[model samples]
Target chain A: MTKKIFPSWIAVDWGTSNLRLWAMDDTANILGSAESPLGMNAIAGDPKLSFEAVLIDLIEDWLGAAPAKLPVVICGMAGAKQGWLEAPYCDVPARPSDLAKGAVTPNVTDPRISVFILPGLCQRADPDVMRGEETQLVGFMAQNPDFAGWVCLPGTHSKWAHVSTGMIRGFRTYMSGEVFALLFQHSILRHSVDDTWDDASFADAVRKASEQPTAFLHSLFGVRAGALVAPVGASVAPGASVLSGTVIGAEIADVLGLLQPGENIALIGAGKLASLYQAALAVHGYRAALQDGAAITLSGLRQAHDTLISPPQET
Target chain B: MTKKIFPSWIAVDWGTSNLRLWAMDDTANILGSAESPLGMNAIAGDPKLSFEAVLIDLIEDWLGAAPAKLPVVICGMAGAKQGWLEAPYCDVPARPSDLAKGAVTPNVTDPRISVFILPGLCQRADPDVMRGEETQLVGFMAQNPDFAGWVCLPGTHSKWAHVSTGMIRGFRTYMSGEVFALLFQHSILRHSVDDTWDDASFADAVRKASEQPTAFLHSLFGVRAGALVAPVGASVAPGASVLSGTVIGAEIADVLGLLQPGENIALIGAGKLASLYQAALAVHGYRAALQDGAAITLSGLRQAHDTLISPPQET
Candidate 1:
């Protein structure tokens, strides 16, 4: 027989518009990786291709002719109501380890794959839900089994969750980034703002937002007014700064009262997005510790995989 | 020669996208009226068609062939820097009667028309400006003359101006309506919302936004989350309602602190938009007196016409 080098398992993180897969070895080190634009929404209209076909297309090169089935751990919107499989939400207060119990195995025709979709977390009282993020939270818990703090997964829809002793107590989602994108890309504010803005301008905006938070409704118009009356002064790079700062500032101000007492904040995201949050948090006197978003995602999938595919550890 | 039935004066209210004309008799009574799509933005591209050509196209039928120069009093963005004539803004607190003093006249080829573009209102301290609404304020002043209260002119850009005695003291603009349109028409909220929500749903959303006003950051997502989780109950018709209520609620909360110490609000606008503001205000514990937006607009234009075109009365 040919020398066998098939990896142990596959990890999938599928969202609305994008999909990513990592082939991991038995020890959970990534052996290979692939990504596709075929997200859940893509499969919705592709009557010609099954979700399995799409998934396999992305990772088919990584799979040999071996008959062994790879245990694929999937998370995010791929498990949404409209996704390939309906993985019902794991209602809060949900424990990180117990997340695997709610996992749903969507029957796939491919004998080459055994897929386990992890359930997202939902809070019925406040009527809040989070997908993909709960996996990151589980990853964080796997790394720090006893840390009690706040975990912020900032993106298009930024999520701030409360964690204490491996349980996600509560969480809130802010549409700050989405609002910023809509305004910057499509609204009148786009006319004035540019790419280059000063840090000072951003800080001023954040301060303005935090100090007189209610003035936000009025401030939204200020961008347009400023652009019209004093283009050089109001715009000229500062316009974008103000828009971004104002959005983040309002978000921080709203969530400020809800943050747990103490200074522990684990900002688990990579790249410039996480850095901006760190900077914004510093303005409010909260020093958030940064962690890699992708790293934690991998950790989470590994945790779920171990909990599911591996035999229960001796009690 | 045919007996001249042409009005002695013509009133023009030209905005960015639309133009309105009223052929007022010497006594300032409307003899005929016409409107067109030849707004400031429309004539921006056609060098062959001067703004005069477009205006003449709309009002030529009303103008008699007589050699007498008809004084055309105009207001709105037609006076903007980018408009037909750059009618500079009069500084606040600006008297309604003084708007014409700052009027700029564009040289005319047609001797039958003498156009005077009235200046808009501008505040230096806060850097705010209004072009068309000042005319509406002047109109409101023409009716009451001594009415001292808040005049809210709601539209795409809703303006809440403070008028005391005969001056437009100070004002602020809220982008609540614009933001709502963007989110409802362009954002994800549109998919879930219908046009069937009741008063109670709106009231609940308004109350939620007003009470824990800071929770607005969280509430925006509640609309999307609610749509996904409890679409049957919370969104549906309630989606649009909640979006509007949340926006209006936040506006009230922010502007609430800035409202002058009084109970009287002159709700100046037309139709359903005005009524909604009335309901929103009631939620915030204020009963606003309603007035017609167009009626005031015409009244103000007439006031401007009388102040500028009519013979100065010896007081």
Candidate 2:
């Protein structure tokens, strides 16, 4: 019979709601991948055994019967305190490569797999924390070694990081996305907002909110009040765009103070939210170069894995 | 038996969530009062019949056997388009007396009562509307006729009106109260906030948010983040006061621009919320005189009632 070859390791992006795994070879190329909704939050009845069972259930085929111990690298909320095993945060003003140094290996009964959970980052003075995004940041830096300015990773909890000389200086998080969702779905404005999008209404709201940032509190109610008094044409709602614009505009106006005049901005992530951020930035005359978050996350995980295999001094 | 005495007219303050009735003398004194949870929003089936049923259920005894048709002066959401009858809005830059002119009398099945639903005020230029609060505004002005600055009525949807020379020149509304409740109980910050009260934290947050209003978005997340990495001493949650402070402070900062350097401010309402607004203003070196919103609502209903009893021109 012809000899068979197997993948070298596995990479996992385990967050609160989803689990994604990638099989990689010695060349760091993806050989195969698998995904499941069983994230860190889904583990029950003895976390260690549950996690091991879930992992084995998904990738048991790749493990083969009595195969050599495979290195499984993990990132995101799986390293949280309430997660499988805590990999404490690496403080700010540190290199992304520092993630591996703080990573922790959890004991596994399955002889074929060895798991390593990567550490997140934390800023003590300002009190901010990030899990999976740190890996993405490292990947971005790995691609553009000379990049120095602001990197915005937009999501449910949007993060804005300041980077220079291969070090993450500091960062701030905004709950704008979460707030928008809450207000749109739960607040009194719910009666006046829906999935509608109007570019003109959005642009006007962006400008007005930027001009008078303090007016945000007052203007928020205007979305409902405006729709009540003079709704858009035939539709009952005129606020869907205005609500989104005001939120994004308020975020931009606040973060503007952190940027230098004409500073370089790289926006990471994909889909409609990222596009909205890009459009919002353009509203302020700023052009942001977009980057793919998935690719960067993989690159960052590989960087950590490489570090784990060979210490910098030994290499 | 001596001739039994009864109220000449019944004053009603039927809002979105509650229906309040007061047996008033000709001088606007409340003799007997009754209230029910069935406000305009609670009416089911035929609106006219449902509303009449709810009103008669609560105040039927007041309308004794063989009573004459008593004037029932009603205010608030009862006049909303979706309520008993659509009483259109009275345009702003109007006198308190204007509410009665725009009032529409809804036909009632009961011959013992003559119903008049007072109209709410609307600002056509800026597109703002108020149902019950407009009555409270008129009441505030009635108590302090010389007061000509800003009237801050804080509630679920807070209203700020600019009054000068016995006319409401303009006004704005903020959803600060609603936003606070949502964030405190529904958002991610819910995990880090509760009913805990910390005056120092509240005041400090007020000062910071006031000085940097644009930072409100970023600072909001900081409340959750701050709790995570560095929680308050011995408490898992340290954000209750900060959340309230940030919301109220942002409102104060935004409305500050609308006021002159030494403008007078009258805050209408009761309980902890009103106190918080008062404290937030003091952080900016402004003192807001507190007024009882319940008393003011009654006074406003009386004003509208007086208007209905005797047409200003006819009187």
Candidate 3:
């Protein structure tokens, strides 16, 4: 008798504005990857039908002749109230096991396709919450068994989590990125700097922010005057840098002040944003280790899938 | 010999999105105030012509006279690069004396009119800047001779100023109000709350924010989830309050942390926004006194006009 082997399940991290998909073997090695702009927000109503069409089309393009009955697990904003299938929120101090055991409704369109949706985690005492990053945090925990302390996932809305004993003890979020975009794009100071950061301006802002953190907002208005009144020349990069640094630096100071000295800081995100956070942390005397969010999500999805396929004894 | 006295001077605060005109008597008491949707931005080109037309139309109805000419001092974004005439910027720690000594250009269409367009202020070391608020700040300084420390002007783009020894030494702008609007009107959290904040929700948010200042963004996400997962009869006020509190509280915390302990904080602006800033400051152990924005602007404009008309001090 020949035994049949289904390689492994797929992992998906779909958010409000973007989508990321990965195909991994049983060992969680990613064999292929795909991305699209069809975020949940773009396909909220009638998502079941729309998502199926897009998913099927993408899968056919990627796997070619591969069948459509493969098992898959998804996380992030794609499972929110407005997502493809409203995956209800899971309460926090949530763990990998908790997320793995969380409830999920079947995809209405495809009964043959077994899909597991991860729920966002929320705190009971405070108004704090996390959707997609919790899954990535679980993946990070799976990779580093003894990891503890804070993990900051920076993006449009950055999340800072306090993890201990393999559970997300607590977390906070900062609208640093959004604030930066609005100020730079929509506010009066937009003309202060031409869309890029000047090294001198950036350095000065960082230093000033660190020193006179209270004067942050007050200092922001200086950008416009510096450009128009003082005739700072065409190089508004310094001004832009200072604006960016002050906000980010203020966030760092707020976060660091909340944490004790020598607390471990892990940064999980991608590209320039992650680097900026890393640099800001370093400026404030914190050593933040980097982690790729995509990798962590894949690992986390696999760990969650394993928990479901192999049910362990509950304590 | 008869000394001439201008019957009325038109005080205009022309911003990007709204135009406010005040008919002021010799003493600068606003005899009548009028607002129109015809802002500087609405007039794509020939701002002087467009502005003159709008002002003439609005005033003709009130004054019952043919509107050929009127002495006016315009401030705010109308004096921007895209404004009627770029009023050029002034160096920071700007003072009434500096504004008094600032330059003015006559209207291109009506050269007989001496229009004093107020200049924005900029900081030498940072990218921060401000425009119309300089006039308002000057007005505040005129009223309170001993006023020093931080003056927070709340608006779409909130400004925090360091006023010492009658000089606007430094300031910073926070996009807090604008962020609140964008998040509630445009971002993912828009659907979480109703248009207004109820008592419970507002108080709860303010309290939570004061306690856990860092968890602001995380708390914001809870607004949506709370509405979804909570009891059907659950009040949406808490969710909205949480959102409001998080942004406002975080801003207050950032500003307070930026300033020295026990420094005097003055809340300057008009209406509900100023009151909100005052409330936020009170929450953070600072009693912020309120100053009327319009009154300040008028005083500042009067001072500026007086200075311009006075003879220059010889070296």
DockQ of each: 0.49, 0.64, 0.28
lDDT of 1 by residue, A246-299 (tens): 888888887776666763677899787778788888888888888888889989
**Interface RMSD values for all candidates:** 2.0, 1.8, 4.1
The local lDDT score (0 to 100) that residue A39 gets in candidate 1 is 84
Where is model 2 more than 4 Å wrong at Cα? A1-5, A44-48, A56-70, A108-114, A231-238, A311-315, B1-3, B44-70, B108-114, B124-126, B231-237, B311-315
Candidate 2: deviation at residue A63, Å? 5.2
For model 2, residues A89-124, the per-residue Cα lDDT tens digits are: 888977866888888998889889999999988887
lDDT (10s digit) by residue, model 3, range A163-199: 8778888877766787678778876667665756665
| lDDT (Cα atoms) of all candidates against the true structure | 0.80, 0.83, 0.71
Which residues of candidate 1, in runs, are more than 4 Å off?
A1-8, A25-28, A53-70, A109-113, A144-149, A231-237, A309-315, B1-8, B25-28, B56-69, B109-113, B145-149, B215-217, B231-237, B309-315
- Looking at candidate 1, what is the lDDT of residue A66? 68
What is the C-alpha lDDT profile of model 2 across B1-315, one tens digit per residue?
A: 533447888888998888788987887777788888887767843345488778877677777664478888888999898888989888888788887778898888888988989888888556689998889999988888888888999988899999888888888888889988889988999888866789888998898787778877777887877767774474533598888888888888888877876567889998988999999988888788789988898898888878887766742
Candidate numbers, best lDDT first, in rank order: 2, 1, 3
Number of the top-ranking candidate, with lDDT as the measure? 2
What TM-score does chain A of model 1 get? 0.90
State which candidate has the highest TM-score.
2
Instruction: Order the candidate numbers by TM-score, best to worst.
Output: 2, 1, 3
Better-scoring candidate (DockQ), 1 or 2: 2
